[model samples]
Target: MPDRSSPETRAVLRAAVPPARRLLPVVLLGVASAGSSIALLAASAWLIARAAEQPPILYLSLGVVGVRAFALGRATFRYLERLTGHDAAFRQLASIRSGIYERMLPSAPDGLGMLRRGDLLARFTSDVDDLQFVTLRAVQPFVSAAIVLVAAVAGLAFLAPGSSLGVLACLVVGIGAAVLAERIAADRGARRLAPLRGDLQSAVVEHVTSLETLVAFDAAERSRTRIADLGERLARATRAQAASAGAAAAVMSALGGIAVLASIAGGLPQLASGRLDGPAFAVLCLVPLAIAEVAAAVPVAVAAWRTARVSAERIATAVPAEPPSGVVRPPAAAVAFPSGAGAPTLALRGVRAAWPETGTPSGPVLDGVDLDLAPGERVLLRGPSGTGKTTLAHVLVRFLDYGGSYRIDGVEAAELDPAEVRRRIGLVEQRPWLFDEDLRQNLLFARDTASDDELLAVLDRVGLGEWARERGGLYAPVGERGVLVSGGQAQRIALARAMLADFPVVVLDEPTANVDPDTAGRLLDDLLDAAGERTVLLIMHSVEVPAGVDRVVELTGRG
Candidate 1:
């Protein structure tokens, strides 16, 4: 569990608060809305009691008008309050999510392995959303209610001091009781709700994504049982929180009745002594009911605070305050990438690196790796499994930081911005991710300005053009994770995407890892041929190295 006072948690909570300018209208409107409700009730009470005396019609005109005005004001202000409040909250939610995403970028892919896909989804989508309540349900309502409560009590004080004191005392006691009930009944449940919800969501995602494997292994029923068990836990927690909220509302309702009784009892003596008129006494008795309604927001606000705090803590835990070890952090003033080249020369000497999750360099995956790629050269990098071929690929793209010297065009790669380095050198992972969209949409993301003819041409270059035409041009669906395509075809599409990107140097990491043995040789040849003079670092393991132009280097996994 993350401490609520941790800097990361505090930062996340702060992001939930919209700018004062944006939130001010919400607060002001809420104050007006709650104030109108109180005034409307008071005005109605006065009008009804004063009418019983058979006063002239003209004498009742002011009271009737006051009632109408307050009623209209209440509805109008309430509508504006909701609109502004929700607007501010939604804007703040966007800011909070953007901040979290910006922080995650430095540790994405490798460093974020600790976050499972379902858990990450819950944190990013669900937990971040809960922070919005900090404004909507908690701060806005609490501030507005407090102001209205104070003003209502003060107005009563001027009318009948005794009744005012009684109402004030009842309010204090009632609010205290409500808050106490909420804390006792719901605090634990509110705190547990976020994590439990996240757990359940994660289990559902895992079960759905792995349903095929579960059924194949005869464990689908078991998985379903686990999901059911998680859902039950979440439901129980939700019920406990709901019950607590109901208890608080019940306390406030009981307080309202007690307040009305206290007002009547205190006002009766004044009524008989002629100090208080019938209209004033009626106002005293009826106002507390409206005030009690406004006061109901207090316990609910407390609950919202608890829930938001837990969500903030979870967000802080999900995205680290700082990037972990071995994760690349952009320099404060990064040097620009060396410009002017068909393909820049790449050189590395004594380079060492580790995955970000390792948290230290003591167990480096790639140690003392020395390799060089001349301009427009095609090099084959061969190694057995676990020889750090993929690690080297990641380093070349600046996904993971490296030690020692790595230079591009004789300029130190570390000094250049990682984004700039990535623009120059692209990586096609062994398993490329294809969005579940038509083929054109997938290729367009690489270079959005590419024409349809250009896309077809690149597809042809990577041996996917004829296949794409058969499927239906660029409109064919790739399915989620490219499940609709074969392993070899997926690789070809990935290469097509790279070709469209037009990186100066491309790192192909185990491109044939997923294809059958007989097809691997042909796929490798087509991929290299598609390179057409761009520097290529082809990483291969278990597959035989095809005849290449420049050179072949093998990593022995020895420092």
Candidate 2:
């Protein structure tokens, strides 16, 4: 059995059920359809038996009309059941996906980035679909089956009291078998099927996305073989579920058959004694079959519940809980850097930090780092790749935590509010993101009410002023991720955003990463000129720090 109190289990159950008011009509329609089906079959038997004795046409007319009405009612109600049920399911699934996405946003490119791309895709696509089945197939079917069962038994009780007891006996046994089957298979369903499906998804996605790399490296056959192995495991899990479903169906059938035969056996004596009529016996026999049809849904619901619960766990793991709301934000006010002695120094003493790997501290990515950026100082921090240069930049903006003392204007770094700290220190990291929006909207992220003159001035600093003027000035589309612009232009646009922020401390990580030496030199000069007296930590490689009014510090392995 699933741990009913587990958070994933609770979430899965809650998402699958929706509100009772919304699902009531769906369940009631299902019950109506099942009742009509039972009535139609029973009426057919009554008309056949009564007509065999040559009853008058007038007497048989009611039975014939009942068969017609029940038949049409069955079809209409079944259609309504499907239509109503699917509408609710769609609405519920949309809400579920939206909630997951909203929770995922705050943790983006951090907690969410830990999952492989394939696993993430599977959760949003296949796993979400599996959860949808819980509402549409699992929960709906069970509720419908229950209501119909109660109505069917009540009808039999009015027809033949003695046979009603037999019918009830049959139902209990049939439903009991289904419940037992579910209990036996629940754990296996969760333990085996979910992981296999996720692995298969990851394998196929990895192979497809990396096909070019595999072929170039001559590992195409190897990737194909690995995919086949994952496929085999998935197949096994599917077969196991199918087997369990088949067994549950078989058990329900066996108990149902026994119940029907028992009802008939018990009815023969009533018939012999003239206590039950021919039509009543036929109705009694048919009632068990109708109830069995509803009872059979139990095992399928079990499987769907298992699938959805596993999906819930995966989704919960992928998106961390949102941080508490109503944060005490400091009042927005201009920060005046202390300008007298030492010029608002940002000092670090024996700073050590590491990027976390799997919830544990990784090998020191930043070690024994000591640095200071006094106000109006433009420091060029030169380093080789993977030497924690960008990591250190992350540290400066409070994006990461560091050991030892870090002070800005004589205040502990950790003691300050993170949001205000970030506002005071701006960043133009390597490969900055640009949405598919016009240039004005992009600049608004840095300053919401920046005037036209201010925007144009910064754009001109990045040498994109003429480009902007030619393309509708501040309203040109930059396409997705600025794809319409050249690589150098994208970098320049990012630099413009940082310049517009006008923070006291600014960090530029590889601002010239995509430019030629001549272009890079020119861009650096433009940036430094625009920067003016702001304290800047510029991380660059290969190119010399061009005539900057600042000193260059080259990192050597440590920190």
Candidate 3:
């Protein structure tokens, strides 16, 4: 298993599929397209000059046929190149996205907490999209251009190697311009990466997360100023990159002029010596443009490659360093546990955990913790603030990788796939995430085909039946993150979602924290009633343990 936090994780992630295999189709098509384009330009130039001389139709026939064939081939190959390139890039992007998601699974909300939501969104969305350069604007074009350039120069040598040297000289000048453009683009790339460094993105996420609070505090003006500042900075950085790209484009156009002049200068001597025919001289003058066109793409390709590298570096932080051994292999079919069935055996000893990349010197958040829950047993996990109560809850759900022996059904938890364990041991976090969807949609998210009766039953179990019924039944929209509902109502809806999953064991993390004592008691009682024979781990900060909880386990807070 590679350490995901290390630099090598990027390499490991990128090697998920064979590189050459994925790139072959796009590269082949691109090379064909570029080759055909060069041939078309030379053929058309020759055909036009021969026709102007009033040569016999048969003498011009070969050039005319060659021009037509190259034209058709160029267009056809270019269309195929785009189709192949985008298709391959999209497929690679999908796999990379899924791999990133799976790698980030164990960390969950805590891992997400390490980075701001906005920055993280940038990584998962934009940064990942930047990887399309693996084919689209980077590798395929770079390789194809090199091949086409070589072929063009080699063919020009047959007419006059002396003139070919001039074409080669022009290529050198074009390359120098591209290199200069890349240097400028590289500097701007550094500036562009700064906005995603948590400051700018953090503000965006914070203002949105606390929009209501900011409005109450009358800090909207302050936030707007900050956002404007960030926007301006980002805009300046973007313009710098665009300017660099424009410079590269200008170099391409300049290369065309330079190559054309060199062609005339180099080919005129060959024409005077009678070593090259007039029609052939026309070929020499235009052929350099083909090679120039390909070489001119170097600067943009370099910039695209750099952008992908920056994105890869940022996204590497979110990918776990130590992926489990078997994650690459498909998981075996799951063994189903009936709803409300008695729980599997749960045990832990010398358990410890810390956020992987947080660089916290205080060590593991939860240390040397020990607990055991018999089938159908209910346990309360109690601790002070920052004492790792939430960590323990996450451990129970296999959300966090821990230091010691943690097992379910007498098998080590590490031995089971984290995703598979989550299927059997459902968790309701402190702050549940509700999508902007109808009640039925949210409930059905757990079990897609769950009957309406089952959904209504779970809502009743979580004490949200009246709430659901009064609010346009199950089809009623819940607004963004359930903003339309009270804190307590949101919590209940999340609980209902879990109830619908009906795992054999459940871990409730501070589920009643936002409600009044009486409401808390009622919710707790209702949850216990709903659990019935199922094992439960109730993680709470308060000492108000409800009746019927089997036992209470306090954190020793020792490593």
lDDT of each: 0.89, 0.76, 0.76
lDDT-sorted candidate list, best first: 1, 3, 2
- Candidate 1 on 1-559: residue-level lDDT in tens? 1334777778887889888998889999999999999999999999999999999999999999999999999999999999999999999999888887888888887888777778878999999889989999988999889998999989988988777788889999999999899889988888889888888889999998898999999999998899899889889999999999999999999999999888788788889999999899999989989989999998888888888888999998887778888888888899877877689999999998988776554688988999999988888888888888899999999989999899999999889999999888999999999999999999999999999999999999998988999999999999998889998898888888888888989999898989988999899889999988889998887545686647889898743
Give candidate 1 misplaced runs (Cα > 4 Å).
1-4, 359-362, 547-549
lDDT of 3 by residue, 351-441 (tens): 8876545535867787888889888899888877788888777777765678889878777777666667777788888888889888899
Whole-model lDDT for model 1 versus the true structure? 0.89
Model 3: weakest 10-residue lDDT segment is 322-331
lDDT of 2 by residue, 364-428 (tens): 67788889898889898988888888778877877666788888888777676666677778888
Worst 10 residues of 2 by lDDT: 322-331
Q: lDDT of model 2 at residue 22?
A: 82
For model 3 the local lDDT of residue 222 reads: 98
Candidate 1 colliding pairs: none
TM-scores, each model vs. reference: 0.95, 0.76, 0.82
